[model samples]
Target: MPFKPSRRHLHTATYVDNKLYILSGFDDSIGIKGIAGIAGKQFFYLDVSVPFNTQEILWHDLTNINLVPSHIGAGSVKGGTNNNTIVLCGGRYLANAENKASVYTFDTRSNSWSIPTIIGESYIRRRRDLTAIINDDGKIYLFGGSLIGYNIVVNDMLILDTINLSWGKSSTLNAPIPRVYYGADLLPNQTIIYIGGETFVNQSLTLNEVYMYDTINDNWSTKKTSGSIPSNRAGLSAVLGLDGQRVIIFGGYRNNRIISAQDSLYTLNINTFEWTIPKIFGNIPGPRCLHKANLIGNYMVISFGMGYQQSESDILLLDISNNDEYKWVINFNPPISSSSPTSPTSPSSPTQIFAQKSAAAIIGIVIGSLISSILLTVGIFFLYKWTKNRRIQKNETSTSDNYNLQRTSVITATNNYNQSSQGVISTTLTNNKVYNHGRENEEIMKIHDNEDNPINDENIISEVTEIKNHGQESISVNNNQSSSIQNINNINNIDNNVVQYLKDEMIQVVRQEVNQLINSDNSNNNY
Candidate 1:
């Protein structure tokens, strides 16, 4: 009980149900079957709920207790939705056939290990050394890392639904390219932040991009970052701040060396997407990489990682937590508990009432605003349609009336026309006419329609020809012209009696056309 797990770099640890569960990692150790030397039952847990000093702290070693077969680490670690299960997925193989066993879980309640019956994990064996996180909905999201048995990093993202015990691939829009050894942390808003990592070429190179994933919408986004941002590096460690609005990142490898402690400490404001070198005052921990930082309240518990040979950079066992009073301590303290009274006699305070009322008001405002927006949009759309129809009708009426009225001048010398107010009309004619034989006069008549000619309005019926006569020229003149031409005694003039008969026949034709037009207009209006 006095001894602790061996110092290791590539191990995995996470807090669940007030217990910190540790998993397998790489160290100076031998392996079985020529597999991972870092693989073994290097797994353990510490009850952080109980108070203890570092000197007397007990590490519950699960190394021998119902040993998990193919126990491996440096994979993704997340607490289950049930809140008691710790899930580990994708890591260096501890067994020769570790491909068949991609998942290993530990049940704290049963004090036992298990490999949950999963359904969709067929190519999951190929995924290795990836980072994992669980959202409130119990979905485990795994991101960038090297593929199993291969040195190249992958660009793939896989999701494990903890509720259904199934695996699926993420179809992300604009996801980040393949990389590995990056630092990642999940925000309370179900967003994941991926910090600097490296991708392989002839050798590994730093990936400076900051990738953000929105789990709700299944999209990836990158935003502009400002402030004193740290230089791009990989193999760093990131932990969410206790405030739930920021993330603190620690040392990583950069420029072929561990980043110095002086430039190692930085904070990212999740709300603002800004970075800053936080002020610290104490024995600063040495520069390191591939480490893990766990936030326990006001202090960050930084674990083991690789370091430089300089004495200042030789050790990384320090608490850079508060960023205000940085220190190296062997003390473990319980977080201050704020317990509310559960007495039945306890009355609700004014503050609580006000908060409830304020919440109700905000919700009401949001719902009301949404409904109003929809109604306003609908109203505008319908109004536009109605106005368009009305305009169309008015144009059609104007065109019919204008051309119809102008046509009166073509038919008679007095130039008179009449109709009802509607677009379809009934016309009355005032008869007055005079004609001279010396003048060459012709009139073109056309009927207009409401088609796509609102500007020039050329949508018209074929032109009507002015009547002229050589064999029947007598009917071509007006009534007075016809009467006056009958007295003329010329060799070209037709017999007087024949001219009279022709004039009478022409009048009859004119009368029939007028009656037909009036009937057509009446029929249109009725229709």
Candidate 2:
């Protein structure tokens, strides 16, 4: 009786090698003067095989052997190669705060405590009221905890490989709501079922809504459960049944009162997620909340909780060997499964792994498509600007070429006019003969630079020649006629304006001669 554990709640009980190993917990109320709650130092267990009736029913106190750190509300998972290991981490408050998430491990075989070397980045040190479960591969999955400060994070699913001793995060999306004070356990396949928890707001949420976490693929989903769902509860303990297919749920904090006298026992089928109450008989334990339950062979042994009118050191066992007839028992005949019921993580389990990875691949494809579209838009914008600039440059070059060609055409026309001056080109002449040029003619002097000059410094003799030849094209015919205009008036039926060269004296002489020829045609119809 000297080794018996005092009245305590928030302690941890883990089954290892047929022994119920009980660890640190809080003795007083957690809310007594802020964070001033007494942490229990006693660490012991009862070899469940021999208990109560025999002298062998005694607590093996390992309290004085090696000083174990006191912790309250710490998450502990039973694991290891031989399955005699308990990995404990985080708490409402740990006595040793320096290396909070060093993740202490206890070997029940040697009864030793040691911190394994962590390989990679763990991100956060410690958290309170977090849920932890170890898979068959010895990887501990930590999720849903209360944060210590801004630095200490337990937010995303944290993973710790117990074998290699490495730390990492799941980085999984669509996680469950952040909660505390919940009971979580593996359900047959590496699929974990977590139920009965409170939010950060201190409001007790309904236990009807449960979430299944797939540890293999790192994802969370809500499994459809039917048949008499439990009410809103907290401080409830959910232990996997001895049958290995159902979760046995027991006493919880219900409607402002602790479930003490009136016992609550329900069975949730892990495969179907359906809840069913098994028949009960024979002195069910009364007035307990925030307790830990472990299935040993044919009995459901619950220990260490806030219980009234009962010795904390006393044993409470419910015999569940008979499927429908579950009665309280002091001792068990033989333990059901050799393996821990909580450790459902086996070699072939969790079929939910592959489907989630396919979804991740789809997300990756969408991200790649978005990046490609951005690059395409940028390329098209640059190409359009380049085309517009090139077109403007081409237009300017074309205008320059046209100007050069027009100037070259005007120069060629002026040279042709000088060459054709010798021939009496029969063409009409008028005051509208000036060429309308769009550009400034820098070579205007070229027009006046012709070899055959239209006018010299002084030349009135050429004007007389033009007046004497006005009557006829032949000089002999017009020489006798002194008055060249009078003979030209006798001519008829002639309407031709002919220019020999640019040497037509001031143009007035030619105009007057032409007027005389027109008057002759009108005056005398007869030639």
Model 2 Cα lDDT, one tens digit per residue, 1-527: 46656667777888777778887787644432124646776788877654353222577887875445676777788887767788887775546544455477888867888877678745656676666787777888888777665433334677888788778888557676777777778766887788877776666767666788888777878766778787777778777776788888787776546765544788888777788878888766666767787776677778867654543234577777776768876655545444542343356324434434533443344334333443443354346435544654464455446555765686687866445333222212111121224324322111122244322222212121121122233322122222332333332112112122222432344344334543543344232
Q: In order, what lDDT does every prediction score?
A: 0.61, 0.62
* Residue ranges of candidate 2 with Cα displaced over 4 Å: 29-36, 51-57, 94-101, 150-155, 260-263, 311-314, 334-527
lDDT of 1: 0.61
The global Cα lDDT (0 to 1) of model 2 is 0.62
Please provide TM-scores, in order, for all candidate models, with all chains considered together: 0.58, 0.59
- Please state every model's RMSD to the true fold in angstroms: 23.5, 32.6
Off by over 4 Å in 1: 29-38, 53-57, 69-73, 97-99, 202-208, 308-328, 338-527
Number of the predicted model whose lDDT against the real structure is largest: 2
Candidate 1 versus the native: TM-score? 0.58
